[model samples]
Target chain A: MIDVGGTEGGVRLRAPRHRVARRAVLWWSCQAASRVVVLLAAVGFGAWWSPFPNRALVIALIVLGVLGIGYVTVMPWWRYRVHRWETTESAVYTAAGWLSREWRVAPMSRIQTVDTARGPLQRALGLSSVTVTTASAAGPLTIDGLERDVAADLAERLTRTTQATPGDAT
Target chain B: MNEFPPEEATAAPTPPPGPFEDWQRLDPKAVVASTALVVAPMFPIVAIMAVSDDGSTRTLTTAGVLLGVVVLTLVGSWLRWYFTRFRVTAERFELREGNISRSFRSIPRERVRSVDLTAPVVHRLLGISVVKIGTGQKAGSEGELKLDAISTARAEELRRLLLRPRAGTTPESATPPVADSAEETGTELARMRPTWYLYSTLTASLLLFTWAAVGSALSTLSDVFRALWAADTATDWLSDTASSVWTHAPLWAVVVAAVVTVLVGGLLGALAFSVEMWWGFRLTREGDATLRVRRGLLTTRAVSLERRRLRGVELAEPMLLRLAGGSRLTAVATGLEHGETSGRSDNKALLPPAPRGVAGRIGALVLERPGTLEDGAPLRAHPRVALRRRLSRVLLPALLLASGLAVAAHQSEVVPWWSWLVPLGTAPPAVVLAWDAYRNLGHGHRDEYLVTRYGTGVKRTVLLQREGIIGWRISQSPLQRLAGLLTVSATTAAGNGYYSVRDAEAEQGLSFAESCVPGLLSPFLEKNSEFTSESVDSLDGTSHERAKKRTDHP
Candidate 1:
């Protein structure tokens, strides 16, 4: 957590109040590792049956393996540093993405639904994701890699606020 | 707010609402129109079968099937006409439809946002039209209702009634506001110009359309020739010409001739299409401030939109059309868009490919303001790094590929000598394209409208209303962060859902976003409190805030 706002208003865009749970880094790395493993296995099988020369295959393998290992090692930590979310009395705000940082804000009156979902990997890691949808087709705001209890509490509070508010949401 | 008497509310949960009015049914002529439309395609099939000289049993069977289908269609349409009925109420519009699995649909009158009337050639001949009532809800929800084959006059009346405020609903307001008169009158806004068809020929879509048509025609012709194996005379003549034509002409000559023919055919096709599509194009501000567009030669369509639902206008200038000083106009209004991936929806077309001046003028008029697109606030240019990024997007990949090709060429005699030059040869054009795209990236505001312009092949300028925006999104890539550039998007329910100002300096974009929607981003900002507000304000905070929200929504 980086605290940039404390009774201070300014021109710069401050990070959201709370960062994603620390375990999110491990969870993300595990997910990436699984993908890398699957790719490696696929490459090994392809190389066994491939028509290409040994020299070419070796070069390709080296390039792919290095890239995969780098991605699996770096992406999770980078994402953890960038991802953050907060909910105020009037709006929901979130910052996400590893290579690209996307900051989103949805006011309470415009929010149509608040939903919480859990993947198998996330369930194993005791993590959940909360999605807040508005009428705009641009997309919903998703806060991934939150602690299970925190996500549930956030969803509950968001649902209550949306229900209390009045609008057509369009 | 329940308009029905107290006893009726107690009697039934969903009762027929109006006692003074009788239930109305679709025009009976719809049966004829429906039969004609369905049977028209089968006419050629029936004619071909009749003349084929096939076996008597097969011919008779085919005729029998056709007759049975027509009879089934007639019975279905009659049943539909007999069962369907609708009526207006003080607060709700109720409809009952279907004979087998009946349904009663009721919509609160105040929820209606648009009432459209469309009539195909056959329906036009019978003086009936299809009325679609949109409640402005997204994704064709329960708010959408359709009435097929009603008298056009009745549809016009319904359009007026549905759009105008009710009599007692605004008793104190009395008449409508000065700007929006509560009367059933039309103000002519724009009309079709004959010379505008010339610009249609300059569109890339004309080429696409003609190419598709030519391909299908060629394939169909080949299929017919293959089937005519027994008729040597037809096949022999075609084969003789195909074999000898190329022998007499050089390859370059043939290519030139083919290109010329295709271009000519495409232009002619575009001309015919433009004329038919916009034969009597007329845009008008009709009863209760609803915008109505009436067009088409054979199949006239009357599409309507509520003025309140209009969010903005989009001006599209495709490369060729822009070169010809022609641009297209589309309404960024709720309930106007239909179907995903449609790309082109005439219902939302305020003006076809016309002069750019005309498009901009009409767009401003529709926005209900008299200022030009850049009246007060000139569009601010994106950072120079944005252009550098665009150039790199093309030059980097091209350079890398060119180097690889050059290395491969040096290593082998089998590699073509020209392959290395190909990427380098294309770089100049790509550079030009990147520069064009960069030049087009701009964002500004004119009074109540926020305008953004982007793209190269088809530069689009969107003039979106500030109040219509529901949310905000700001994004920055890793590379952009290094360059201090970010993209800010305004999310609204109208026109593409979101419009972005791409690749602006971080602080410049944040401040622009803040200025566009006053308080929405202020609370989220953290500066010296110079251009930002510290604490978040609840929408339902106080009487003052509630009043501000009321004004904002309206």
Candidate 2:
């Protein structure tokens, strides 16, 4: 629904196949704000009976409040992207990013594992994260915030492809 | 390092094709054993509560507890049964399992690292065993892939397919055929003596547990004594009885103390034996390429580990064990880097514990020579970098504290002296730690292997081929800048264990470490392994800089 990259294929040309997830801005901002609020609440409660000036405390609170507000407001315009996975003849390509793009091609034969996980919040949103692992590789390619059906379909496809071509190196 | 020869293209080992043998359903005995172990610990408290003022069983509570145990036992048994499933496919060993969300995974014949067959004493009596397929993925990640409770003949066949070295069999020829036990090869591979290193660590760990148990026992005894002595009616009666008994037996206290010590010590020793025997162990080598270890008593495990996957071998002799000429050796593979990989519930069994002499035999079987076995010169700090190293060590604490004070002074009521103590107290330990670090640091090429030994009390020596290093990083901190030094860290596919060198030699060391890489271990782009012992030794020539400078302008 949200346009994350410049091209329809997104930004897969400049950066690694998986850049920072586009939804990370919204997710991380929410997380950072929640943490800040909890910290501030604890500090305020702990200092409730202290002789420290309320005026100074108010000023400090205001500063943090403004920063949190600014972050939530400007995060949408951040130069990040989301990846779309497409199956190829021998491999699967994952494309993402905005300013810098990355295209990762994992051949069907080399796929070691396909794991799909959905956090409580993501589950509520009907979204899941799928990580595709290749044997003898540095790290798995993770695509977060995909619709549940899409993630399931992708996982099934990768699994089928892996089984069909045993040791068919791309 | 010299270039490693190409791995010959041959049929990968697999589980021997056999008849679809369904594991005998787990007997009800496991439920009884589980209940005994879990329920016995709570008996004392339950008895105390039940034996009220007059001594009559609380009927309701007793029934409830019994019902709870029965329900727990059933659930445990069912879960155990549900997770165990296995099938032998044409080209892969496939397992389908899971209680919540079922998963089906298969390892291609070539991807199977090792297949291990283990027979627990009980299983052996029943002519049954478990087959463990060690895939390239870290150990234990797959919870129940093991073909558990299978017949002895089936297990042996699986072991042969997974453990035997490559012969002339090709992938096409490896198709599943009529299932049966593999023919017993006349020559059995050499068996390694149990690595005793785990024994010392075990002894140390058990001592702590003994102390805790003794403390708990003393406290409980004191409470019971106080309860009896403090009771008005019991005190007078107990005093009169004690007086009469003591008059007759003055040696009671000493006898009690002796009995307590013996009982406590026996309990401690028994607990240690129970744990040590958990994996009633076995170690065998298949050709030179694989080390087969079978351990665990209840959920018996057998791991056929590939020697090539080993990133490092650590042999340790604790202070106490040093006297007994005992050493412990740990053979670590890439799977070790990911803590959760060893899917086995018993983490300790991933590496079998063995005695020093036996560990040496293991090292030999895996084609590794621990530092103790090697004739390498003892490592020492390069004299030229010693002053810089010493100065650098002192500088870190001083700067850290000074900065801490600067930050504190700006915001807190705390004095700079308090902040300075932070660094001042750290200065000595920092120096000691740095000295220890320098003492333990050494990296050298051992033929095609890149060998590095470091660490103080728990010294570790990593042995990996140059092809193992995936990448290298050069890092410099502000403090390091003052010391005119940089640290180069090398990463291998195995993950965390890195080879780092500091001070003046870092640049050349980083280059040398990188040159060892066979085009990044990941994505495993097959290239001619680009290192040889002769080329590695060539870097040893002292005139490296001079030779480079001359060649640059030539």
Candidate 3:
């Protein structure tokens, strides 16, 4: 319900609703754990084989482990708080990224296609993501972490909008 | 879809025409020219061997083998020329080629965008030219069709026929009647100036500095001389003279001498290259709403660009070129591939290196409007925080290096105290560059075009059409967010399609985007004032206002 071009000025944008399932934290943590394990294994092997010194290896392992644990516990929540997406009659707005937040707006008339995808873990969690592709060089806009049914409904609505609007010239 | 009438269908439809009936072969001279080009590289090797006094049976046998290769290549090229053939029907243009595994392609007549004609010195003498047809597609050779070594007259005829607008099919066909009258004989748009060409040659020769530096190294120089002279006596004499000069002169003097020699040689080479490439450059507007550029001294190239496909113009001014008050203009258009055959990305360049004023005039003529791009309005500069960001970026690396060197000097006797001076010596120039870059950053819009200017080394001022932009991307780093700044990129289909205005205030960037494309971004921006009110009230008011505006506009 944002004003399009009012002298009253300034439209308040609607942010996306519905956070991803809480289990998403566990899924991301497991991915982070595998990387930490490889780093620890490398440092342990260096300590056993290198004749120069092992003190640095021990210090490195401790520092890395602390950082990894912090990242695993904290990053997903921060990402979920920042990521947002919304689709209106004329345009789709997507905001994403952790360190450098990026906001993109692609008009419905420019959209080439819309698709919904579900990975194995997402299927287990009953969550899905939708991708909106347009004839732009900035590439496609993807919104992840929605209920499976909601993702399907959004994708269908986007498809209908694109079909009704013509003229996607590249 | 329409079906045939029932009575006509019962009567039986006429059999369709065969695809290959009208296929025609290219001129036979093309086979000879291609074979000669392939064989040209062997001449130097053969000459070296001949001068080395190798008269043994092995030498004879090698010559015999080379002769066999030449014969085989000649036969192969002839076969290829015989196999390649093309046909032009009313609905489509078809090309078929290949000896073992063949490829057949048929492109619809409506999809053909432009046909370009070119001729090298040899081809020009032989009265033959190469033709390429573009279909306005984005990816690789699938978008292009080439026909090499046709009669020049036929190429011109084909170009005219292929580019003629189909009646009532495309809106572009509805050009004004004035253009129709001008179509009988094309009007000259722009021509190269010799003085500007000289400036372009000197500025473009900057790459030669790297080659000169590498060539001055003694080991590489000796290797080159040894290879060229071949005989041991010649190599010894050359090395002895070189070493004697090196011994007599101080090290710095020798370096200076080498640098001077390299610079002179490079300048001469660049001068010759520019003279050959841009000798007779000219741009003309044809009646079919196409721009045709003809240039090159020895190898002539004529490129045809459809006017409708051109998105805008880019003025690129390299630091040295800008100092000389010169800039080059490149067309921002789709289907213009960066081809390797020409040396300077010449396919995209509409105007050669010229004075800034001349470039503006030519750009206006090409766009078919005066004062469209060069509106003379002052551009809005980014916030002062942008300057602070640039300064910090430049100074941080220097500070780190100076500190690292100081620490090393303190810890080790081998580290010299004077080495710490390196970063200090570089800081002044770095600061100047950062300030210059900040000063150059600007963005503005006029009528249908959005103009942005940026760069430190090679300043680029791009004029892009507002309607061409398909979306907007707003990005902000954590630091940028703290400073209330963001970078906005206007995404289009032409060129790389990411034109950015960096370090602008977030609200300013959002408002610019909204104004450029109207409703596309207005609905998404959250005004600071609106957030103070209840969400429902703000939303309802905005939507209703938007609807009212739409109806009023309609």
Q: Give me the displacement of residue B124 in model 1, in angstroms.
A: 1.6
TM-scores of all predicted structures = 0.85, 0.55, 0.85
Error of 1 at A112 (Å): 2.1
User: After best superposition, candidate 3 residue A160: deviation in angstroms?
Assistant: 4.0
- Candidate 1 is graded, for docking, as acceptable
Instruction: Report how far residue A39 has shifted in candidate 3, in Å.
Output: 4.7
Score residue B15 of candidate 2 by CA lDDT: 35
Name the runs in model 1 displaced over 4 angstroms: A1-10, A51-55, A58-63, B1-24, B49-58, B79-88, B93-106, B140-144, B166-185, B213-236, B338-341, B528-554
TM-score of chain B of each: 0.84, 0.60, 0.83
| Comparing 1 and 2 on TM-score, the stronger one | 1
Writing each residue's lDDT as its tens digit, candidate 1 over B1-554 gives 22323443323433232321346777778888898888876776666556564466866876798889899999999999888887665567778889999988988877787787888999998988988887766665465788887877667656666676566543223223442343444788899888988887677887687678778977875664454333357678888996698889898988998899878888887788778778899888865467878888888887887788888999989999999999989888766554243455677888878999888888887778885454666699998999999999999999999999989998999998779899999899999999999999999888888889999998999999998888899998889999889899998877677889999878888888888877677666776444332222222123223323433353
Best candidate according to DockQ: 3
Q: What local distance difference test score does each model get?
A: 0.77, 0.51, 0.73
| Best-to-worst TM-score order | 1, 3, 2
Give each candidate's interface RMSD in Å: 9.6, 22.2, 7.0
Listed per model in order, the count of residue pairs whose N, CA or C atoms clash below 3 Å is: 5, 31, 1
Q: What is residue B439's positional error in candidate 1, in angstroms? A: 1.1
DockQ of each: 0.34, 0.04, 0.41
Predicted candidate 2 versus true structure: per-residue lDDT over B1-554, tens digit per residue = 12222222112254323322222233233334444546654565455445543444454566488669867966775676556465544456666656788776877655665566666555665666656565645334552256655566556655665544444255334433422222232223333334432353444434555667677987886575464343456668978987787777769775796689876775556455445444445555544566656555454556666666666555555434444555555554554324334333232233333455555555544545543334455433433464456657577668876787877776777664456566666677667756765666666666566666655444545555555543343445545545445554554445343455544253344334434553221221112232221121112122223322332343
